[model samples]
Target: MTSRPTPRRAVLTAALAVAAAASPFASATPAFAGASGSGPGPAEGAVDHRAWATFPQWSAGRGAGTRVIGGTRPGLVIGDPIGTHEYRDPHTGTTAAWEYATWLSPVRTLPAPATEVVVSFNARTPAGTWLQTELRGTYTDRTRTPWYVMGRWTSGDAAGDIRRTSVDGQGDGKSSVSTDTLAVDNPASGLRLASYELRLTLYRRPGTRLTPTVWRLGAMASDIPDRFTVPASRPGEGAGHRLRVPRYSQEIHKGQYPEYDNGGEAWCSPTSSQMVIEYWGHRPSREDLAWVDPAYADPQVCHAARHTYDNQYKGCGNWPFNAAYAATYPDLQAVVTRLRSLNDAERLVRAGIPLITSQSFLASELEGAGYGTAGHLMCVVGFTESGDVVANDPASPSNAAVERVYRRRQFENIWLRTKRHNAQGEVRNGSGGICYLYFPLRPTTRQARALASVGVR
Candidate 1:
């Protein structure tokens, strides 16, 4: 086994205390009450509408569909005619749009002593549009009056490729809006359940009607996780020496893979997953790599179509599809069934698992899609107490190694889209229908040996 540094004992001790305090109780009084869009003053406590809504699920390499991870809440529809057709791109005929708006009903109760409320969603804007997608939150108090305009996150401009905008005033050279996290907590309002709506709006020239291709919706809590500090290491210190992994191009060439000139193949999931293993000084047991290779070969295993009608592949390595696939497949029906049964966030926290992904941008996706650009991989490492997901995206030029926090709803919309589950209840490649290998966080010698017997090193 590799000798990785363990988290400080104090940090783990404090986290346990926080977890104990947040345990759910059957007798706990509901937080928010009344109906959605009631009045503006605080209602009862805070009922997270997102948790109760139904979300869509897209088959690996297929188009989008609706489903939720934990509950049976149905997903909302955006654009015209709900849940009928996906928003499509005008120039390329590809689909693009944020998922639908999912909010809690007014009659539902909120978590007890609700002090905060938040809503999040995953968005993928159309290419070449000035604006990618629009997300809005409407917080109503007991009176059904609009209490606050929470904030908005915008992607794109009048014309250009798609980009992600942060609501916290942090973005990658894209126009953005801001929201205050602390303002949502108001004891006096006596708010109960919070209702929210996320719309996938498109933008065109001043008088032109904008069109979008896809849209997704969901919600998460606004409470921040207790902060735990890691032992400080100087820049380029600790495991830095082992972090050097081959670039995507090099990996492809060295592995003797096909040249993706026709934009039909997807390397995003596999490439990114591989980077996480390599950078962390971990290698995929022979079994893990075996599952991954076949998964990448077959495009139909995922939500976004891997190949064009011309037989050219547009695999996960490149744009709109890269973003689209990440958004849709991660939360597919099969995978959600497994995730909903477990407390994922809590389990990861306990296991010290470092989550990661393939975060390709328009430029990278375009280049990779066009068979001209190399791919990039990223990691999602942290979350706030209230469940805001954070990523350690390596694609950003300035903060490549830094953490970027996103609302959990937004993060999950994308993350869930990429998750793959086979018939046997295991993670696999959606396109090729191959089972990917999984390694327990702490493997016993017998388990390791059993894995090796199946050709996993």
Candidate 2:
């Protein structure tokens, strides 16, 4: 094995996983995977997206002491205390008693076997309340995988932060969880997940009325081909269109919050998340920023770095963690999904939704980046008239330098491919066109159609 490690799957040994991203398909999902016609099941294609966000969807879940809410924005909530348990936060070693209730989603079988699965949601976890998401899968051999903890999270620090995080060292001999992704151990073995169910355990301080309301609960299961390069989409489809998103470079705050993911450049995930979040008119309150250094340039960026930091991953690049963090904002919902091509991204971008993409590339591979990264996250704001990619890359030295237009062919190759070569010319994995989408909980009709066209609800 040549010695260059994957920044995302393994960030610490050789280098950190700081990367960029690609686009996807948003075809209408069938009601369930393997179901005829489009229904609520798994999306049928190279990628499958299934979500529960409507009244009927919430009502379908088997809830124990959990209320199926009916309203303009439907969801599930803690109806009554099912039981109590004490949680010892691994990050802080703080133990506390919490009353919890559960909501189990209907099992979804993929139309095609999947090598990886990622779960995300949009929920409001008030102070004294948080949620735990877990996944249990059935393999092609009909054997089942253990329930893997996807995330333990809250939106803000109001409840002492609780240090929202993903668990590590969780896996069976067959499959495992890498940060926010639940994946098969060896796709080469043809051991893929056939079906899976998600569990949401809502927790709150005991002896209180606090409850967590989740409006969007979903997962993306995909079997992306492993390739060194992919066919790029035709250029200039939605050119000359770019949204005005806030720009904050990860390099600017280098060395400021070293405790978070070891500080500095490791913060690309949260930094990119914060930019899109503010573009939608949300920011941390003054009290929220009170802990950050006053002299810091953009306190919100620092705030995001701290809040989205994953103690187990020891970095801020956790995919679902960042999506969950974006959902913490008012009237917002976020999900992590894969896109087929930049054309799909253009559809969403035209609909006023910016995306945070993960990618790895050599400096020589992607023009004008001026640097190579193992893994990095950046915001794709728009496309130029020439069909070039206009992104608010946080890797810049200053905020003003954050916006960049890159060649479509080169950008797509790096962000979309599954296999790549490091500086040492050793082959490694790419992000496989993974991206984070943040949008309104109640979207406009145009936005809804755009999201649906890209296979999101």
Candidate 3:
């Protein structure tokens, strides 16, 4: 789901109102300080910031007690995984600490002032065990803020599919499934050298013998330049500019499958995800999508919606959730990252991968598309000979009406401009220039080189 800023908020309100309202980050201030050696260099239109801390590189926590199981072993989780222990307090009859483990990442710096930062990884643990992923950053002043909880998820079938149930401190205890990863947003204004510490904590009941395991962890940050302008000349760019991508429309499925957020009308995210998933030649089996409407031709989209829905957020368009859901598929390397521009996106299209992009625009802001949306998700299938955007927009009335083109400049503004009104009516940038790339870990010969050139798996 592209982050349609306005209508989606309205959707959230309307849905919550019907249910009499469903339910729904960073610490402290440090003196500003400069980064060491200027940190990383930036790209022209956008900066791609990435820092990874796989288990092998992580050291057990100190000062506070830390726990580790088979450290960095294949098929083994190497983080804290202790069962709960209960004790009675003077005032309270009984008390318990479900949280029992902690793992920390080596401090690093974010290359840019990012609009979004997401931590992703794979893990396995028995049912009932809960895990919390949090991140804290050191400022230029050399002081660190307290940890910010990104998400809480329980372990699920590592090989079967990514089923992650995200829970809040106060949740219904319904487990969620993800594609082996979870993410949270850091809305800190202005970019700081935030590639600092990423903490992973594990929790479980006192009697539960099974412990949560974490196999891998990674963090990515994305930001775009204040403004981007297409170079005056590009000799061969946009020259064979059309990608062969299948189309799906969200409107067609509207109200069809109410179980998954009213089906199609609210399904642009999963519908768009399905198009890319199928483009990679992978589709869910009938049994996998059996929960969907039998009358629907593409039940896989419905399956995606069910899997990507965040119980706490109460929406299917959570950016990291969508990317994590795509990664659940076999042999796919997917991530919730941002692209610098159409130029960078075209690189993916040329590599045989289409991007699921988020944007918001007025109906009149973008031409060809019949309506405007506060936030929306669409596919960047290819470019026109003139360097325009050709998108597989699921917002259309039907699958046949899904494809459309827009001037490159106009589309860029809609896609790159991230400022929007919050629930309080103040404007702020949410996730900026966010896009997900779902591609095979290994590509065919024709696309192998292209994928390599763009740093895609």
CA RMSD of each candidate after superposition: 17.9, 5.3, 9.3
Question: What are the lDDT figures for the candidates, one per model?
Answer: 0.29, 0.80, 0.55
RMSD of 3: 9.3
Per-model TM against the reference: 0.32, 0.89, 0.70
Q: How many clashes in candidate 3? A: 22
Which of the two, 1 or 2, has more lDDT?
2
lDDT of 1 by residue, 384-444 (tens): 5555545444332222333455544433422322123222443221110011222342345
- State the lDDT of candidate 3 residue by residue for 63-172, as single tens digits: 12344444333222323444343333222233545546565666656543333345665454465565567767554445454565666554332332223444333211
Off by over 4 Å in 1: 1-109, 128-182, 185-210, 222-325, 328-457
TM-score of 3: 0.70
- lDDT value, residue 33 of candidate 3: 15
Ranked candidates (TM-score, high to low): 2, 3, 1
User: How many clashes in candidate 2?
Assistant: 24
